[model samples]
Target: MHGEFWQLDNKNPDAKLYYKDHCIDYNELEAQVQQAVNSLPSERCLIALVAQSTLDFVIFYLAALRQSHVVLLIDAALAENDRNELLEHYQVNLLIEGNKIHSLSDYTHQLADELCLLLSTSGSTGSPKLVKLSKANLVANCSSINQFLPIIKDDVVMTFLPLSYSFGLSILHTHLAMGANIVLQSDSPMSADFWHNFEHYKVTSFYGVPLSYQLLNRLGLEKMPLGNVRYMAQAGGKLLARDWQLLSDYTHNNNIDFFVMYGQTEATARIAYLPAEYFSRQIGFIGKEIPGVELQLLDSEGERVEQFDSQGELCVRGSNIFGGYSETLVELSYFENIPLLHTGDIAIQSPSGLYQIVGRSKRICKIAGRRINLDELQSWLDALCQFEVVCVGSEDEIVVYSEQPIEAEVIKQLATKLKCHSRLIQTIVLEAIPRLSNSKVDYHALKQ
Candidate 1:
C-alpha cells in the first residue's frame, strides 16, 4: 500500500484527508496507487488520462509515474475526436480511463531508457508539438518551485481548473512534493458546492487564469463565502486593468497575497511570478524570474537590452524547461542548459525592477500605416464592455472580430477610446472564432 509521492504510513495511522462525510488516512490512497501500478502493464505504457482532479485521478497519475510509464495528459474540455486523434497519432498501445483501476499487483518493467511522459504543446507555427518529459523533469521543477513557496504539509488547495494544462500541472507537482491536500470538486464554479467545498475543506490557496478573476469580479465576490484563502495566484493569460483594479483592492483589504505568475509549457509550467506586495500601480507586470531561473531581453539582432523600461523579446533560462519533443518514429533528444527560450512575448523592464508582458509579437498588426498591438487594443475593448475581441490583419487592412459585433456607434466610440482613425479599421461579428487544440485562437488559420 505504497508508491510514488507518498509511502503507505500504516504505522502512523494518524494522517488524514478530508471528505464531505468522512476522512481518509494516507494508507488508503497509497495502497490504491500501488495496486493500480501493479495491475497495469508498465513496460512502454502510453495511455490517455481522463481523471477529474478527484482522489482517483491523483492516485492513478502518481502510480503510473512511480512505475516509469509514459502518460499523456488530456484536458477534459478537449473535443473527443481531438483526444482520440492525439492518442492514435502516438500509436499508444494501451488506454486508461475511469475512476477505478482494476486492482492487480502483477506488472512488468524494462524501462531504463524509454520515454516517460508525452506533453503536447501548441508550437509557434500553430501545430501540436509533443515534448517528452521524464520523471526527472517533473520532480525537479516541483522541488524547485517548492523551495520559494513555503507550502506546509497538508495545506489546503482548491483546484477549480483542468489538471491537463501546464499551470495546473505545476500545482499538482508542488502539492505532491509537500504532500499537501487538494480540495477537488467536479461541478461548475458557479455551483453552490464550489464555494461550499472551499469553505468546508478550509482551503488556503488557489490558482486561476485572468479570465477567472475577471469573471469573479463581474459576478461580485463581495458576499461570497470564500472563508479564508491565504493566497490566490493568476496565470494562463493577462489580467487587464479593470479586473486587476478590483482584485488588488479586494486582496489587499483581505490581507491575502496575490501572485501574478508567467511561464510556458516549455518550462514545465512556470518561470516567473510577481510577489503579491507589488500590485495596483503596475498591474500587468509578471514579477521577477522564478527561483533557479534567469531572464533576458533580445531584439532581432540577438543582443541583450539592459536599459530599464525598455521593450524587447523576453527569454528564459532555467532547469524547469522541459526536454526536447518526442518523435513519432522513435529517437530521444535531451535538452541541455540552453541559454534562452525566445518567448514571442514582448516585455519591458520597469524602473522598479519588474517585468511586464505588454503583448505578443505575433499578435501585432499594421493598421493602415500605423503599427497597432492587438492585445493592447483588446484591453481597451474589455474596459468598454468586457467583450472578447481579437484582431487579425490582411495585406493592407486590419479586421477585428467579436462575438457580439459592435455597432457603428460603438466603433466610433472605440476609435475615440483607442485614439485610432476610424476608417482604417474594419469590425465584424461572428458567432465563434476557431481556436487550436490547446484552446488558443488560431490566428494563422484565420489568415486568408
Candidate 2:
C-alpha cells in the first residue's frame, strides 16, 4: 500500500486555506490535489519541487505524496546553477516550478517504495547532501508535534517560513493535519503586507527561527496587535537566554504560549520542545523531548552521559528519525534504517531533566592552548553587547561579527573573559548579519 503521509481526505471539509483574499476549503483543496495528482506520471519518480509558501505549493506537495512520488523539496529562491546541478545529479524525473510542471526526464530511476521526501540539510548553500525521510517519518513527527501544541480547528496560522525547510514544513504538516486554517504568503514578516494579512485573517500562530524572533523583538513586539495569536514557537537555532527571557516575559504577560524548540532536519522537524507552561522557569533549556521521541547525551566514547550538567553530544531515537542521507540514485533505491541519529550538538541535562544545548561538537576551536565553544562565545558576546553577534573561529583566533559597532573596550573585556590575548579576538561590524531564507544565520555567507 502507498503510504499517505497527510490524510487530507479525512480532514474537515470546512477548514479553509487563505491566500490573498481567496479562501478554499479542505474539500476543494482535496479536489485540486487529485487534479494535480492525475496530471503527474503514475510511476514512482524523484520530483524536484520548488517550494514557495503558496497554495500551489501546498496542493502540489499533497498531490505528489498522495501519488507516492519521492519529492525533493527545493527552496524557491535557490540559485539557478545550484538548482540545475542538484536536479541533474539526482536524475529527477519531474520538475514542479510554480504553477507549471515540467517533465525533466523520461528515464525512471528505481526508488524505495517507503521513501517519500528528500530535504536539503542546509537552507543557505543549497547543499547537495539530502536527508532521506519516509512516510512514517513525516507522520510520526507531525503526531508528536501535535501532541504538544494546542491546535484546534478554528486556529489560524500564517506561513512565512519557506515550506522547504524542515521546521517550516512541520508547521504546514501539523496545522493541516489538524484541519486548521493556513494563510499562505511569501511576504517577509518585516513587511507591512504580512502584518496586514496576519491581522485581517486573525492569524493565531506562527513559527520563527532565532533571527526572526530577534528582528521581531527589535520591531517592538509588545506594540504590535496580537490579540488572535495564541502561541509563538522558536526553533532553527538557540535563541539567546536574554532574548528568550524577553520573549517569555512578553508571551507570559500577553497570555500567549511561547515554545522554545530544538531539532535538526534529520529528525524530520522537532526532537524536543519547551512547553509554554515551563518557559518562565527554563529560560535557555529545551524542556523535554516530544512525544514518541527519546533523547540521550553521549560522550566521545558513545556511552550515554548520566551526570546532570555535564556536556555530551545529543543523540535522538524515534520513529521520526530520517531513513538516511541520499546523494545518488542508488542511495534512493534502498532505505537505510538509522535507528539513532547523532545530532552533533553538545548539550547538558539539568537535574530537573531539562536539556539545554551548549554548542555544536564541530563549533569548538582552540587558541593559545585553550578550547573555546563558538556558540558559548557568541552567547557571551550577545549578552555583553546587548545585540546580535555571530562568532566563527580558526585554530589561532576567533572572529566576531555584529551588526552594530562594538567598542574596543568590549573586545578587550571579552579577551580577558576568555583568558586569551586581545589580538586573538577580532570584531567586524556589518550592516546586517547574513541569514538564510529560513532566517537562520548563514555562517557560510559570513565566512565568505
Candidate 3:
C-alpha cells in the first residue's frame, strides 16, 4: 500500500493511523486494503465514493486505486438531488459508502487508464462539473509540495477539513506520500472533544481555510497552549490581511512557521505558496510558484502583463494541471488539449516579484458604468472592520451584506473609495454570509 514512499517502512509497522481510541499499523492497513480490494469489481469503470475520514474510507479508497478503478470523490453530506445528478451525469456504476456498495447505472464509455481521481471544483456552486485528475497529476502535485514543505516521516497531522475538498485531500496525499502518520478526527473544531483529542494525540501540524482561522480567532487562539504544533497552513480561500497578520504574529512569537498557499482543483491542488521566511514582508502575497509549475498573468487579449500591480487573469502550466472537466460520461474520455489554464482569478505581480490576488473575474460588476470588483471591496471591508461582507448587485447598484451593522461613515468611505455616489451603495445586515459546504462564500445563494 505504501507504493513508492513506504519502501523502507515495511519492517517498522508502527501505528500509522489514529482514529478515536483505535490504532491501525501499516501492516494491518495493507492487509485490510487487500481484503477490501478482493471484493471490488475487477472491470474498469467509474465509481462514486461518498467520502468520510474514517479507517474504512482510507482502506476502500486505496483499494479502489489499487484495482485501477476511477473514483469520483463526493461529499457524504451532499443533498440527494445533487448526488443523483452526479451519479447520472458520470454514469457511475458503483456507490461505495461505509460498508455498503450499491450498483448504480452502467457506464459504457471508455475512460482513460491514467484517470484515477475525480473531485468537484472546490465550492462548486451546486454544479455537476467534476475535475478528472490522473495518477500522474496527483504524483506530480505531491512531489512539488514535498519539495518545499519537506513532509517528515514522523509528522502527525490533525485532520479538520473533509476529504472531499481538494486542500483536505492534498493533506492526506502529501502526508501519505512522505510516510507520515495521520490523526483522523471526524468532529467539528467547535466541539471541546476535538481540542481534547488534538492535545491527547499531540498533533504536530494543522491545516485550515479562512473560515477556520476566523473561528480560531473568535476562540482566542493566542490563549490556547498548542506548543506541540510545529506549523500551520492557510488555503482554500483568501484570508484577510489583518487576520493573517494576527496568526502570523502569534506563530512567530511561538517559533512556529505559517504558510499561505494558493491552489485550484484544475491544478490538482497547490500552485503558489509564500515561504515562511518572507511571511511578514509578503503579508498578503501568494508568493512564487511551486516546483514544476509556471505561473503568469495574461491580459484579456492573451498578452502577458509586464507592469507591476497591473491586474490580469492568473494562468498556470504544469504536469499537475488536470485533463479537463467531466459533465457527462462522454466527456470522461476528454483530455485537455490546452496547455495553459487561465484561472478566473484576477491578480497582480508585486514589485517584490510575488503574486497578489485582486479579485475574481466572475465576481466583477459594472456599477454605474464604472467597473467594481466585489472581492476587492470585500477585502477592504475585512481590513476596515471585523464584520464579514459580501458585495452583490447589478450594474446600477452595489449592495453590501454584512454580518453586523455598518455605520454611515463606513459606507461613505467605501463610496468615496469606489468613486461612486453614496446613494449607489446599499448596505444590509445579515446574521451570516451564505457559504457552501466547503466554507467558500456562496455568491449564488447570496443573490437568492
Candidate 4:
C-alpha cells in the first residue's frame, strides 16, 4: 500500500462518511478525490486546502497528497488578516476557496519542495510561526504511527478537531495510510445534536485537547452510550493533574481506553503516546516513547541523565522526527552525535517507566532573586483557587491570570510555596480564559 489506501474495502455500503444523515461511501470519496485531482490545473505550484468539514475538504486533502503538489492547509476559522499574513509568510502560490476547486492556471509548473503545509503555531509568545511541513515529513510520520497503532482496515476515526491543526492532518494521513474509515461530522460540535452524529456514525475513536475534556465534563457525559468507541487521544497544552486524573478515572470506570500523549509542530504531530492500559496506573505521566522513537532527557551538556528524578531537556529521536523547518534549518545544537529534537520542555522520569512534565526551561524565571518555574506557580495558583490559571512574565514580575477573582492571601500562599515574598506577585481576574482558535491560550493577543 504505497499510496491512496490501497487496501480500502470498496464493497462495504456501510462504509459511509457519516456526516449527519448523509452517508458518503468509500467509492464516492475515491471518485470525488480522483475527479478533484484531475480537475486541478497541475500548473499550480502551491495548492491550499482551506475548508472545514465539507466532503470537498477531505477529498481535496487526499487529492493534493496524491497529486504530489505541496498542499497548504489553511484554517477556515482564521481571521482574514491572519490567513493573509500566513500566506504571505509562506509565499503561497495559489488559494483554493471553500467547497470550490477553482482552477489555478497561473502557476505553470511545480517547484521542488515548494511549501506543503504552513502550520500556524499557538502564537503564545508572538505571531504564530508557520511550521512548513513537507510531504516527506507527512509520509514518514504517518508510516511511523502504523508501527504503534495498527492501522487495520476495521479501524474508524472521527475528525472531532478542526482540519487546520497538525493533529487533524495526522488523523487524515494516518487513517488514509491504514485504509481506515474516516467519519466526518457536518454539524458543529456546539450544536445539541452533535453527539447524535457520534452515535449515528458509529465512531470508533476520537482525539482532542484539554478544553475538549473540560467540554465533555460540562456536557455531562455520564450516561451516553458510546458503544463503538475504541480509543481517544489528548495533547496540545499541558493537561492539569486534576483533569488527567478525572479522565483516567473515567476510562477506568468505563472500559474505554484513553491515551494521554505529547508532541510539538517541530516533530510532525506526535512523538509520544501513553498507552491507555497505563492510564489508570500512571495517571499523570505522559507515558513512555512511541514506536520507532527514543525519549531521553539530556543534561545541560547534552549527556543522558541516568538517575531517576533527574530533570533535563526532554529530547526525542526517531524516524518520525522531522529534518528541519521550511524557511531555515535551525540545526538543533547538541553536545554529542545523538540528533535529538531538543524539546525545551523539562521533565523528570520515575522508576516506574513514566515521564512527568515539570516545566519548560524557557518559562522559568527569576522572581525576587529566586528562580521560579511559571508552570509551577500556575499549578500552585490553580490549586489555591481551584480554577485554571496561567502565569506569564512581564519584565521582572510574574503576572497571573485566573477564571475567578482570587484572594490576595491565596497568592501570598503561592508565594510561600515558592518561598518568595508576596510583593513580587500580580494577579489578573478573568471571567474565562481567552483561547486561540486551536483552544490554546492566546498569549500574544492577551498581552494587548
Candidate 5:
C-alpha cells in the first residue's frame, strides 16, 4: 500500500527517475517499492535506515514508510561506533545498511503512532537527539514548499545532498509529492560528471548550501551551461552577502530564479523564503514566513517584539513543526504536540516586513567584558577575507580557524575592528575547514 505521505498512485506513469543512465518510470518505481515492502516485517517496528544516495535507498525508505514502520535515518558514512550506538540506544528492531537488512532485535518497540521519521539534529555531530516527525509534518511541509517553489511533473531534480540531511530529504519529499522526476547521483557539484548528468537529463531545479554556491561561483558559474535550469535554491546556513549578490545577479541575467530560504530540521525543511523577485532588493533577508506558517519574535521576557529592526528570538508555529525530540528509546513512545518551536535564533524584522537572522542565541560569548555574536563576527571576518572562517571561543578567548593563514597584520586589523586586545584573538590554520556531509561547518569537530 502506498504511504499517505506521498501520492504515488496519483503520479503520472511517464514521470521517471534517472540514475546512471537507467530510467524507471513512476509506475515501475511503485512496483519496486511494493516489492521492497514485502521484504520488511509486517508488524510495525522501529527501523534504523542508513540513508545512502542511491535508488535502493529511495525504494527502502518509501517501503518502510509504506509499511507504517517508524524509521530513523542514519548517515551511511557515520562511524561504526556511532552507528551501533544509535541502534543500541533506540533499540532498533531492524537495520537497513545498504542492500543488507539485519534484524538487530526481536523485541517489539512502543513507538508513537504519529512518529514516522527521526532525523538527527545535526548530520555532522553524532548527537543521539533525533527530531521526531509525523506523516502530517512531512505532508504539511511538502505542501508549503510546493506553494512557493514552482515544482511540477515536468521538472527534474538531481539529488546531490545526503538523504540523511533535512534539507536534502525535503528535496526528495517535496519533488516526489509533486510527481517531479528525480535524478539520483552521488557526485559533487565540482565534478564534470555531475554537470554532465545535469546537462544530459535537462535537470531543471538545483539546491545547495552556502558552500555549494561559493564553490560554484569560484568555478565560474556564469561560464557553465545553465540554459535549461529553471531555478536554484540555497539554505542550511547564511550565504555571505557578497556571495548572495553574485548569485542573485547571475541567476537574474540568465533568467533563472534564485531562491534564498531559511529553515531547520524542527520545521521539517523550510520556514521562510526570499522570493526571486525580491532577491536584488532583499539580499540579506530571509524574506517572510512560508504559507500556513506563523513566525513571531519574542524578547528576553517572552513578550512579542513590535518594533522594526529590533532583535528578538524567532519562534515558529505550524503543522510542519516536528512532534518532538527523542533522545532514547523511551522517548520514542512519547509524543508531545509542540505548539511553538523556539528556534533559538535571534533575528530582526525590516520595515518592509522581511526577517533576517542576525545570529544564534547560543552562539554568543563574552570576551574581555564584551559580548560578541560569533555568527556576526564570523560573517564580518568572512566578508573581510572574502572566504569562510570559523569562530569559536569561551569567556576567556576567541579562536579563529581558517583554511588559509591570516597575516599578523590582518589579525591586528581584526583586533582593531573588535576594539579588543590582540591577546584575546588567536588564529589557527588548517588545510580545510571541516564540514559535515551536508556541507555545513562542523563546529563540534572544530571545538574538539
Candidate 6:
C-alpha cells in the first residue's frame, strides 16, 4: 500500500522529522516502522488508531500502510464511549495508541487490497459512517498537491491540525512523500511556545482553518517575527472575506505565498487551490482543480450546470475519489465504481472560470415556510460582531449559540437583518463553542 518513496536517490538522509528537539531520520523511521509492522498479527486487518500529532502515531501509521492494513484514523481526544462505538461499528481487529495494543474484535473486515485508510465523515464527533480511502486515492491526491505546492527536502511544515483530519494527514503524507520534514507541536497555534518553535525550527509553511487565522490575526500577524516562514495555507473552512483579505495583504507585503484550498475527507484531502499569484485577484474563488481532478456543477435534478454564476452542487471526478462509506464489515466491500464525488457544496462558476462556495447543500432549514441558509446567517453575524457563533434550528425556530456573552441588542439586530421574528430567535452563551479536534463546531454536541 505504501508507495516506493524510500527508493528515491535524491532523498536527503539527513532530512528528518522535527518533534521538539528530537530529530528522527528516514532510515531510523523506516526501521522503527518495520519493527512495529513485524509485531502486528497480520496484514489487511482493520486497525483503529487514536492518533495524536506525535512520533508514535507517525511510526505506527507508516507501519500499518506498509502492511496494507486498513487504518481508521480517529482523534485521540475522543471519549471512550465514542471511540469504542467506532471500533464496534467497524469490526476493527486492533486498537493502537502509542505503545499499547488492544485487540478489540475477533472478526476482521475483508476489505479490498486497495483500501488503506478510513476517515470519519464528521470530525471528532464520531459519526459512524466512515470514508474508505484506497492507496490510489491517497497517492493521487498527494501527488496532485505536491505538483502545486512543490515540497522539497529543505521545506519544513508545522503541525497544527489533528492528524485524524484529512487535511492534517495530507500535510504529513505530502511532506513525507517528498522527503520534507515536519515540526510537530501538541500545543495550540496561539500558544507562545508554538511560535517559539515555529521560528526556532524555521518552519517554511503552516496550514490553518479560519479560526486559526482569526486567532493569529488577533495576535498581530504583522508583529510576529516570522522571517523564515515562506508560505501560509488556509482550508478546513471558509475564512471570512475580511480576514482572508487581511491575511493575504500581510502575506503579499511580506513576500509569502498564501493558498486558499478546498477539500473534504471523501476525496482524501485536496480538490482545488487558489494559487498564491491569484491571492489578491481571486478574492472568493476556490480556484481551479488540482492536477488530476475534473470539477463540475450539477443542479438539484442532477443535470450539469454550465451557465456562469448559476449555483449548484459541486461535483468532482478524479482518481483520488474514495471507496464508499463503511458502517460495518459488510459495508467495507462497497467501493464507488464511479470516481465521481458529489461534494454537497452549493457553488457558482464565476465568469473567470473559478468556483465560489455560496453555501452547503445540507446547511439550509425551513423557517416559517421560508428557506434560511444558516451558514449565510453565521457569516452575517460574523461580519456584524467579533463573537464566535453557530446557528442551528428547526422548521419554526432558530438557536444561536455564542461562545461569549452577547448583548440582547445583538440578537434583535440579527433577527432584523435576517427578516425573522425576534421572538423566534433564541441565544445561548457558552464560555467556548463546542468544537471538534479539527476546530470545527460540533453540531452533535450543540444539539445536545
Q: Highest lDDT: which candidate?
A: 5
Cα-lDDT of candidate 3 = 0.82
* C-alpha local distance difference test of each model: 0.68, 0.87, 0.82, 0.69, 0.88, 0.83
Point out the higher-scoring one by lDDT: 4 or 6.
Answer: 6
lDDT of 6 at 413: 89
Instruction: Report each candidate's C-alpha RMSD, comma-separated, in the order given.
Output: 4.5, 1.8, 2.1, 4.0, 1.8, 2.3
Candidate 1: residue 296 Cα off by (Å): 0.7
lDDT tens digits by residue: candidate 4, 1-448:
4323423444344455655456677788778778878877565356766857666777777777667676667777777887776656545566777556654435333344434555656532224444666555566667766666545667777776777777766777677666667777534455656677677657777677888877766565575546777777788876776777777777777677888778887777888877778887785578778766788999989899889999989999865555455441221111112257888999999998788888888988887677888877777666667668889974467888877888878877777876767777778878778887677888766677
> Which residue pairs of candidate 1 clash?
none
Q: Candidate 2's residue-wise lDDT over 389-410, tens digit each?
A: 8999998888999889999999
- The clash count of every prediction, one per candidate, is 0, 0, 0, 0, 0, 0
Give me candidate 2's TM-score against the actual structure.
Answer: 0.97
Clashing pairs in 5: none
| Candidate 2 vs 6: which has more TM-score | 2
TM-scores, one per candidate: 0.85, 0.97, 0.95, 0.88, 0.97, 0.93
Error of 1 at 106 (Å): 18
Where does candidate 6 have its weakest 10-residue lDDT segment?
1-10
In terms of lDDT, model 5 sits at: 0.88
Ranked by lDDT from best down, the candidates are 5, 2, 6, 3, 4, 1
In model 3, which range of ten residues has the least summed lDDT? 1-10
lDDT for model 1 = 0.68
lDDT, candidate 4, at 187: 49
- Kindly list the per-residue Cα lDDT of model 5 for residues 283-361, writing each as its tens digit: 7789899999999999999999999999999999999999888898889897789999999999999999999999999
Please give the distance, in angstroms, between residue 407's alpha carbon in candidate 6 and its true position after superposition.
5.4
